[model samples]
Target: MALKMARDDLTEFLAAEFPQVAQDFVIEDVAENRIRVRLATQDRHLRPGGTVSGPSMFALADVGVYLAILAMIGPKALAVTTNCSIDFMRKPAAGADLIAECRLLKLGRVLAVGEVLMMSEGGDAPVARASLTYSIPPE
Candidate 1:
């Protein structure tokens, strides 16, 4: 399906609705069945070993899929995460921005399923993979 919420629409919606975290993420690309999200890396997102923290990666995965769902379903603020599973594969480069490519596998009335693959900017291999499910609120 085509995106109801494009990059600019999603960005503005997040800015207006989730001002708290609006600056942390950027909607890099949005298209039919796909979305690319970036976590604007900062010192606070780095771990002790100078690698991107797990929590930061998780945030990217969560929001990536969340925005993807919103793209298909429009700005549904009530849709909330129901489950998530992530695997941290390789260490993320500390100085590089992290990118998440998300694809919606299913978009049903009550539930949505999607997966995200995260990698460091300019890197070839994936640093983490995540699967997420969101519960779409009733109308």
Candidate 2:
């Protein structure tokens, strides 16, 4: 499918609609069937053991898929997550940026489904995997 929004467009949309997290994440790349994003690791994202927290990883996955959907459907602020399933497979490296690769599985009028694989900045193996469903708002 053709893309409806590019990285700069999404960045502006997020800045206007979700200002709270606008500075935390960046849209790295957007393609026909894939998207790559990175989280600007911060102290608050760290756990007691100096690793990225689970919630942080989950957030990355969720937003990554959401952005991928919006990239196909255009900016829809009301598009909200309805369900998510995340699996933590390995420990993320401390002080390393986290990258999320997302692909859309299905995109319909009312719902969208996608998957994300998250890995450390320079790692080969995914540290976590997630599937997310979002409720697309009416036009």
Candidate 3:
């Protein structure tokens, strides 16, 4: 499917609609039914054990799937997540960025579902995995 929003467009949309977190999340790439995003590592994201925090990883998965939907459906800021399930499989490397690879599994008139695999930047194994479903607001 042709992309409804490009990477730059999604970046700008995120910055405008979600200014507080815009800087931390970067739209790394966009592809058919998929999106790759990075969470720039920051001190605030650490959990004291020299590991990335759970909330931080959850945000990464949430935003990654959100943007993946927008990349295909256009920037619908009102689209809200209705369900999310995340698993923390391993400790993410401290002081390194986290990358989330999101794949949209289903998209319909009012709901979208996707999964995200998050890994430490330059690492081989995934630190977390998440499945999310979003409710697309009516037009």
Candidate 4:
């Protein structure tokens, strides 16, 4: 399917609608059914061991899928997550940003399903993987 939003458009939309977390995520790339996002790791995102926290990784997956859906379906800020299953496979690298590669697995009128694989920057192995289902609001 054709893309409804580009990287810049998604960035602006995120800033306008979700100002609270807008600064934490960077839209790295946007394609048809995929989007890459980076979580700018900060001290607040670190755990006691100085690694990125699970909640922070989960946020990256969540935002990545949300933006991927919006890119396909236009600026539907009301598209909300209906279900999510995330696996924390390994520890994230210290002092490195987390990258989430998200892809839309299925898109229908009422729902969208997607998966996100997260890895620490410069790391080859995945740190986490997530499958999510989002409920698209009626137009």
Candidate 5:
């Protein structure tokens, strides 16, 4: 399906709906079935070893998939994650931003499945991978 929300639209939706952490993320790119999101890493997102925390990476994956779905289906705030499985493959680069490349694997009427590959900005290997399922709300 064609995207219903572009980067600007998604950015605005996030800022308006989730102001708390909206500034932490950036909608870098949006396309037919995929999105690239960046997490502007800060002190709060890091762990004791100066690497991005697991929870912070998970948040990036979750938000990445959520935005990709909204890009295809419009801003459906009610759409929620039903399940997620994330594997932290490696420690993120110290003090570097993180990026999530998300692809929508399936977009059904009531459900959507997406996969996210998380990486440290400018790094070669993936730091984490996640599979997520979201429940789309009824119209």
Candidate 6:
């Protein structure tokens, strides 16, 4: 399937619909079935031990899938995450930005499913993995 929305379109949509977090993420790449996003690392994203916090990582995974869905379906602001399961496999680097590589596994009339592989800027292995399901609003 072809991408219905481009990177700049997605960015503009995010800024208009979710301005609070529009600057926290960057659209690294967007293709037919995959979308890559980067999270800007900052002190607020770190935990007590100077590691990226789980909630911060979760946000990456969530937004990754959300955008992946929109990439194919266009900017459907009402599409919402229904379920998410994330596993942190390793600690993220203290100051390195986190990257989320998300792929759409299924996109149905009412629901969409995607998986995200998250890693630190230049890490060799994945730091976290997540499976997310979203409920798409009817047209």
- C-alpha RMSD by candidate, in order: 0.8, 0.8, 0.7, 0.6, 0.5, 0.6
Ranking by lDDT: 5, 4, 6, 3, 1, 2
Over all chains combined, what TM-score does candidate 2 have?
0.97
* TM-score list, all predictions: 0.97, 0.97, 0.98, 0.98, 0.99, 0.98
TM-score result, candidate 6: 0.98
lDDT of 4 at 136: 97
Evaluate residue 1 in candidate 1 and report its C-alpha lDDT on the 0 to 100 scale. Answer: 68
lDDT of 3 by residue, 65-111 (tens): 99999999997889999999998999998888999999999988899
lDDT (Cα) of model 5: 0.96
Name model 4 segments beyond 4 Å from true: none
Task: Mark the regions of model 6 whose C-alpha exceeds 4 Å error after superposition.
Answer: none
Which pairs of residues have clashing backbones in candidate 1? none
lDDT, residue 13, candidate 5:
99
The whole-model lDDT of each prediction reads 0.93, 0.91, 0.93, 0.95, 0.96, 0.94
lDDT of 2 by residue, 48-122 (tens): 988899999988998898889888999988899999999999999987889999999999999999999999999
Q: For each candidate, how many residue pairs have backbone atoms clashing (under 3 Å)?
A: 0, 0, 0, 0, 0, 0
lDDT assessment of candidate 1: 0.93
Off by over 4 Å in 3: none
Which residue pairs collide in model 3, if any? none
Writing each residue's lDDT as its tens digit, candidate 1 over 31-69 gives 887899999998888999888999989999998999999
lDDT tens per residue, model 5, 1-139: 6889999999999999999999999999999989999999999999998999989998999999999999999999999999999998988999999999999999999999999999898999999999999999999
